[model samples]
Target: MADIKPYTIAIDEERLNDLKTRLSLAKFPDELDEAGWDMGSPLADVKRFVKYWQESYDWRKAEAELNSVPHFVTDIQCDGFEPLAIHFIHVRSKVKGAIPLLFMHGWPGHFQEVLKVLKPLTEDGDGVNYPAFDIVAPSLPNFGFSEGPKKRGFASEQYAETMNKLMLKLGYKEYVTQGGDWGCHISRALAHLYPQYCKATHLNFNSANPPSYFTNPILALQHAILPYTSREQRGVGRSKWFDEQGRGYNSEQCTKPQTLGYALADSPVALLAWIYEKLHDWTDSYPWTEEEVCTWISIYWFSTAGPAASVRIYYETTQNVDGRKNKLDHQGLRAWSPGVKLGFSHFPMDIQVQPSTWVRTLGNVVFEKEHESGGHFATWERPDDIITDVREMFGKGGGAFGVVKDATGYAS
Candidate 1:
């Protein structure tokens, strides 16, 4: 039997009532007099969301809107973990020679991040000079509509395995990828583990250490002689700020997720504040409407694995099982994969934006661009920018042109 089947977003009425009931009975804590965002989510902002979530927010309308996209689910069996019903959106370009592109989303973000780029990436390229793509954006195992793995230790390698297998099952022998946040790490893991199939990768976030004298003599020389650009300096400050004060969520999620998961799973308010804080802090000054904010949280609130399962990835990826951390699991995830071509775009507001040279340390650098403005959620906030970079990288005479050989990424 074919494991892949079409999916529709239909939440049960009882779950909807449960969410409203919980939101109604939520007990909120007091905030300091002038505490803005310096303290986590402001009491007022959350209270507003709670009111909207309970009274004004219509999940059925949101579900109908999401159903407009093409979604499918299939069983992906990882080595250690059981077979999971993975959810994905596969939009095939009409162009016969279109390239297959797998887009991945990270924490606090779901496959919906790929929604904005879908029409442009798959439709707008017709008769245009740029190449078109057969897009596959999957909600990773345990996130969105995908079923979660019940076993422990399903880290990046397992994620890579599931994604790679998903593409292969769809008959894509080779493909390219684009992402930020955990998408960056998971795509990097794919390039590392399955370099044979992942021909090239384009990333908005670059998480890598500086070149070393012993291992990267030439890059180290450049690092020693050249001063960081003004933008790089600011980026360093942003990263430092994150390391110091902004990354409390990471610690809790990575070390003791279950303890935190109880609150996330049980309380609608806890889940709202937990994800809402990231949406606010991770983006540039992009004005977020109430609908946008609630739509995002509601997905998690009604995810297949429940809201709690998503955070376990932090623990699985970080905690060393038996003190044996796989290359795709830890710091080694950002390491270079020899056969894959690379493209990098630097946006100022991303939490860990690195210098162009530093990003080059990660792989065979082919394409690079610096956007005037953008942030971690580049796919949504800067959709055109992300799509332009991909077209430039794989377009005619572009650096990665014909990397997948017959897949020209263009219509004849």
Candidate 2:
């Protein structure tokens, strides 16, 4: 608590002016006639966003609303990386023993995803019906308002360490976590590295490998014996589509983020188009209002570490430039990590839509549910679903019920 400080999101007026100037000079690339999303963010769409961003969108309103949440900053120093001033939202429940829950966001997502579920989760509840939670949602290093590490090799382990330390600093000796995308990976790292503290986890994204006989005997048997359900088959198709068609951004971010950083840093429109493509492609057709789109882009445009620094997470985590074992490497993190209880929510349109059996191999899966809609941004696209799954996972009779010792997440 000594190192923690209250914080607010105040983008400087000069930075706002600079963004407007950049938007004014934004250059547009040509698109073929009727080129609907196949090529990229439609030129017409980008043009519309630019016009809205300059003329109609209001950052001050967004900023004021964002500041209404309880924001805080603290310096979390991971081993071998410089100390980073991590920005987070922490809201406590009035329940006597509310469970501490860490909500993590991945690339292209900021701390905003937590707002939808934050209040609902922290509301006081009877132990038998609903479980309350103390939510801690952090902007990962190099993303949102969190400071970027100056050194390289700040991979998943470092991110997990930063998060774990943040929780411990805030006096949460044991906690649960929920996340998607890179959030899924970091939660795995925490479970593996600090199982005693990271009591349980719930994931919306499936970045799992096929079940192997040695690692997951029961799941492997099920995988080999059972025929693919229609849902599983459709999920495989979605996964294939993502690998083949939608992974160009992943390849570039993993291999050469610095090369792309210039465009993201120099031109606000370039940053918008780059991320807006994913916003359009990744979700389950959730209609994004103009204000919503502008605010999401503005978070990147006016981020404390600058937008370019955010992409480095992809490169640092994927490439073994130093040839270390890298326990937190993306592939390694996907492997089984026992001890912590697990819950999963499967959304059809997510990037890596593995079968339920595949993800079960990752840990002691206690609960799971499948939904027909939603995409990569499950927390945002389907917050109600996320909230329901979490409540059911930790509520009375749930598989992970009372896992966090005294924290039953209810009023006395």
State each candidate's clash count: 1, 0
RMSD of 2: 2.2
- Cα lDDT of model 2 by residue, 1-412, tens digit: 5568889899888988888888888888988888889788999889999999998889999999999988999898988777889999989898766889999999899899999999899985665557988999999999999999988788877888899998888888899999998889899999989998999999998978888888788889999999988879999999998988899999999999999999999998899999999998889998998999999999998888999999998898887735654557867887788899999999998888899888887889999999989998988898999999999999988988898874532111
Which regions in candidate 1 have their CA more than 4 angstroms from the true location? 126-128, 321-325, 406-412
Per-residue alpha-carbon lDDT of model 1 for 1-412, expressed as tens digits?
2667888989999999999999999999998899988689999999999999899999999999889988888898988678999999988898667888999999999998998999888876652367889999999888999999888878888999999998888888889998888898988999888988899998998788788887778988998899998888889888888888899999999999999999999999999999988888888887888898899999998999999999999998887755544545656876767889999888888889787667778889999988888888999889999999999998887888888754433111
- Would you estimate the TM-scores of all the predictions? 0.96, 0.97
lDDT score, candidate 1: 0.87
- Model 1 alpha-carbon miss at residue 84, Å: 0.4
- Consecutive 10-residue window with the lowest summed lDDT within model 2: 403-412
Model 2 spans with C-alpha error above 4 angstroms: 321-326, 406-412
